[model samples]
Target: MSEPVTLRVLGTSVTLLESIRQRAEEELGIRLVYEIHNVQQAQRIAVMQPERYDLYDQWFHNVDFVWPAGAIQPIDIRRIALWDEINDLPKRGRLHTSDKLGAGSLPSERLFVQHDGKLGSQPTERISMLPLTHNADSFAYRPERLPDTLAATEESWSWLINEGWCGHIALQSDAAIGALDAALALQAAGLARFENLGNLRLDEIDQLADLLIKKQHHGHFAAFWSDDQEAGRLMLDPAVSIQSLWSPTLMQLHRAGIQYRLAVPKEGYRAWFGGLSLSRRAEGRVKDAAYAYLNWWLSGWPGAVMARQGFYISNPPRARDYLSAAEWDYWYDGKPAREELPGSDGLPLIDSGERREGGSYAQRMGHISVWNSVMDEHNYLVRRWNDFLRARKAA
Candidate 1:
């Protein structure tokens, strides 16, 4: 028997990993091992040490950090079975719009490889990463606790920093994601404005950091979470009334019979795209196994499992085959679930007739206010973020 192919993937991918593990082994004859890490650790590992992992399944934001480090090799599109069926987000250059960052700053701008060993937007046989799961994120609040006065007003990201929610709010612990969340909240609250929210300037970083520190000093945050379990735990805390949230955690909370409303803020949702990449070290039979894994990821089964957890697959048409009509209508069409919907664990999480908070897939993705990103001043941003974390009151 051959050695198992080891994959370093994000912790959020647990369900997908479990869902596909047995089948992938049966179909490809390659045993798979997954090393799960938080977003920060996953980014660091993928960029600093390729030898430890054969494949990386993570957010595209990490491309800024990993690609230049030469830790990951470009994927050959010809190898991907559904390459043409992939979403137009990359080919149409929609990722580099003016409202978004410039070409150099856009992660998808250099998705294709050039002859100079550099990435470019031009069509090429090689791609930086095989785009996979994506989704829009927003904060959630306990509607019953929401003050009537504020409920009448427009829901906003500024609520994170609102004095009224002091000691009752939570935030993501990741610097990259937390910074974007804070930047949006700061702009909405009129505390500061960013020229390019994805890539913050030094002054913008400082301003946002200072505000976060001040909020911490006042005990504004009830908790800071790094994973779905942590997010779910924080949400269940009576002290927490609102916080940054992801779709999977929302489903988890619902399963536990906790009622929370995912906010459709006036400012819009924080969107993100991510996928699988082969490590620079992968070659020979291991490389073949890696490609097999990537193809299997887009082969419909994994995509359908991800859909149950609120993620959109890159090859939607392929994924459709594995999903039931009720699942498709509830998850993609934004229609109410006609029957009880099972979670990744096959246990019912959503009851019939419950509408998704942001509505349909198109409606949610179309309203993206910002994408998850690694700023040019990432070093300085990390320093400031660490400072805020150090100054925060212990929960």
Candidate 2:
């Protein structure tokens, strides 16, 4: 008897679940190994050693870095068993024509493998990655921690940088995503403006750094976190009043009994779509297993699991079948939960009568102010951002 093929996957913990690994190994007859790292470390590995992973599970914005490095092979659209069922958002860039293409790398923008050997939005047989889970994200806060004056006003991104919240606030630490979060807060507070929030220029990057440094001097932040666990721990600190957050972290907070409100910011939420890409080094049997894993993600079960955790999967309707009518109604349809709903961990997290803060998947997805992005001036932004990270609080 032949040994099962061992397929190595590299990504952040966001989607690298032990359950998924177990099921894939059991169902696909392959030994699936996951190298889970923080987003920054995972990207470094993806670029520094593309041969190390058979499949890369990451966000579309990563194409900005990974594609140019020739780390991943374009997936053949024809080979995707349910390609036709995939929604228009990733393919055409919006769910509806009127839907705004939020600033950054839309799945469509870098999806296709053009004739010139570059990725583009044009329809093509080859795609950079297989679109999988996505979500619209915003900051979470304790309503009791908010002052009455601020509580009365509609929620806004400016709250992150609001002087009133200084010394009680936090931010995501990743330059690619956190910089955009900071930019939105800065723009909302009238502190700075930009031509494209998704693609910051060098001067604009410095402008943000200058302002952020001043804020640091004033002790504006309680923390800056780089991963989900850190973000959740920061949220637990009474000193951390408000911070940009991902859905899973929010859900974990709820489970911990904090009931932190995920703000529907007036400026809209930051959005991101994550997917799987075949490694350039994968070939023959290993490559087949890689494609199998990609296809397996969209096969309804995993999408249903992500859906439970507040992510919308590409081809949601397919995943919908795997969920109960009430689950679909609450998670995707934006209706109140008719009964207590278990989170991805199979524990009850969303209580009965709870409605998703941003309403239905369509409503939430429609309000993206920006997508998680790797800006044109990303490297310079990182250098300055790191400097800010290392800076001391003002006396």
Candidate 3:
């Protein structure tokens, strides 16, 4: 008997879950070896060691990092079974003409593999990555922890760095994302401004980093988390009244006790699109398995799982078939959940009559203010971010 083909899948906790692996292995009759890491570490491994993985499931922005290193090969849309079903959001970078089309590395900016062998937006037969699960992200807050004065006001990103919430806030620790979150807060507070919030220049990075370090010195931030689980536990800390959280973390908080309000910040969401890429080294049967996995994501079930966690799949209508009408209405249509909805654990996550915070899919996505990005000065930004992370107090 032949041994099962084993494909090494690398990604963060967001997509590389044990259940998904089990289901895929069962359904596809292939062995999957998953290597889950924090976003930064996963990208580093993907860029520096392409040989380590057959399938790279990560942020679309990561194509900027891996493509330059010749780490990942282009994906042929012809091989993707449902490529045409994928909405314009990823293919063109906006779902509607009115969509904000936020700054930074939008999927459309670098999705296609151009004639010059470069990642560009030009229509091409090949793409750098296969669009996967994506989401609009914002901070979560314990409404009970908020003082009535602030509670009565509109939700805004400023609360993350404002003096009133000082000593009781937390933020994600990824250099690119954390810096943007801080920049959003700083800009909201009227302390800093930028021409493009997504790609901060060196001066802007320094300004944001310095202000974050000073805030750290003053004990404005209670803690920082790099992973979804870490963010979950951080939110449980009494000191952390508000924190940037992903869908998984929000779900984690929901199951632990009360559901944290997924904030509809007046400033808009920090949006991100995740995708799957094939390692340059992948070939033959191994590459076949990789494509099978990518195609599987758009088939229905996997997308439904992601939708249940508050993410929007690349092909929404297919996932809609797998989800109940209640779920589609609650999640995509932005209508109130008509019935209780189960989470990954098959336990109630959403109660009846609870409207999604940002309204429908189009409404939420249209309001994106920025996308997770890798700026041209990424190295310097990373350095400053690390220095800020290591600072015990302001210099």
Candidate 4:
């Protein structure tokens, strides 16, 4: 038997592994081994240690960090089975707008490879990554904690830093996302305004960091969660009434019978997209296995499974083939569930008559306020982020 092909993937993607492992082995005649890491750690390994993994599944935001290190090579779109049908999001760019397709970032922003080995928004046979799953994110709040006097007020990202919720809130600990969320909250609260939400200037980062430190000193945060499991635990805590939330964590909370509302913040959602990439070192049979895995992911089964948990597959039309009409209406049309729905884990999550917070995939993604990204001053941002964390610990 051949040695198993190794894949380094984000921790949240364990469900994909569980669902596809056996099928991949059966179809490709190769065993698969997975190594999971948090977003930050995954980037470090992909860029600093490409030889360790044959395939990498990660967010597009990290391409800037990893591509420069030559950890991953461009993917040949011709090799992708459904390349042409992969959605206009990755073709024209997420921010692209036309009479036919609505406004959003051009998918080519990170998809196409440039002559200098960097990524660009130009069409090329070579692509930095194969766009996979994406979604908009917002904070969740306990409805029971709502003060009756403010019952009719619209939920806003401002709630994250609202003095009333001080010491009863949590934030993501990942620097790239955490910083962006904090910046959004600060701007919403009129604390500071950033010129670029995705890439903060040093001064802007310092201002946000200082505000976070001050909030920590005032006992504003219940905790900082690094992953979905921790986020779910924090939501279950009585002290935590509101916090940044991911779709998977929200589903997990619902499965546990916890009642919460995923807020559609007036400012809009923090959107993100992730994809699959081939390692620079992957060659021979291992390289073939890597391609096999990527093809399987886009084959619709895994996409259908991811869709159950609030993620949108890059190729929606393909995934639609595997989903029921009721599932499509509930997940994609923003309609109430026709019946109880099972989550990625096969546990019941949404009850009948429940509606998704954001309307449709197009509506949510089109209005993306900012995409998750690493800023131009990433080193400085990391230092300030660490300082904020230390301040919180001291407090």
Give the top-scoring candidate (lDDT): 2
TM-score for candidate 2, residues paired by index: 0.98
* TM-score (C-alpha) between model 4 and the true structure: 0.93
* Residue lDDT tens for model 1, 112-231: 888887877778899888888888888999888886658678889998888878899888988878878888999999999889887889998899999889888878877889987789
Ranked by lDDT from best down, the candidates are: 2, 3, 1, 4
lDDT of each: 0.80, 0.90, 0.88, 0.79
Better of 2 and 4 by lDDT: 2
TM per prediction: 0.93, 0.98, 0.97, 0.93
lDDT of 3 at 31: 95
Candidate 3 lDDT for residue 9: 94
lDDT of 4: 0.79
Q: Tens-digit lDDT track for model 4 on 1-64?
A: 6566554443244344565666677776677776776666777788888887777777777777
After superposition, the stretches of candidate 3 with alpha carbons farther than 4 Å from their true spots are: none
- Our model 1 lands, by Cα RMSD against the true structure, at 2.7
The lowest-lDDT stretch of 10 consecutive residues in candidate 4 is 98-107
Q: Write the per-residue lDDT of candidate 2 for residues 29-137, one digit (tens) a residue.
A: 9999999999999999998799899999999999888899998888998889999999988988889889888887778899899999998999999999899999999
Return the top candidate by TM-score. Answer: 2
Using TM-score as the measure, name the better of candidate 1 and candidate 3.
3
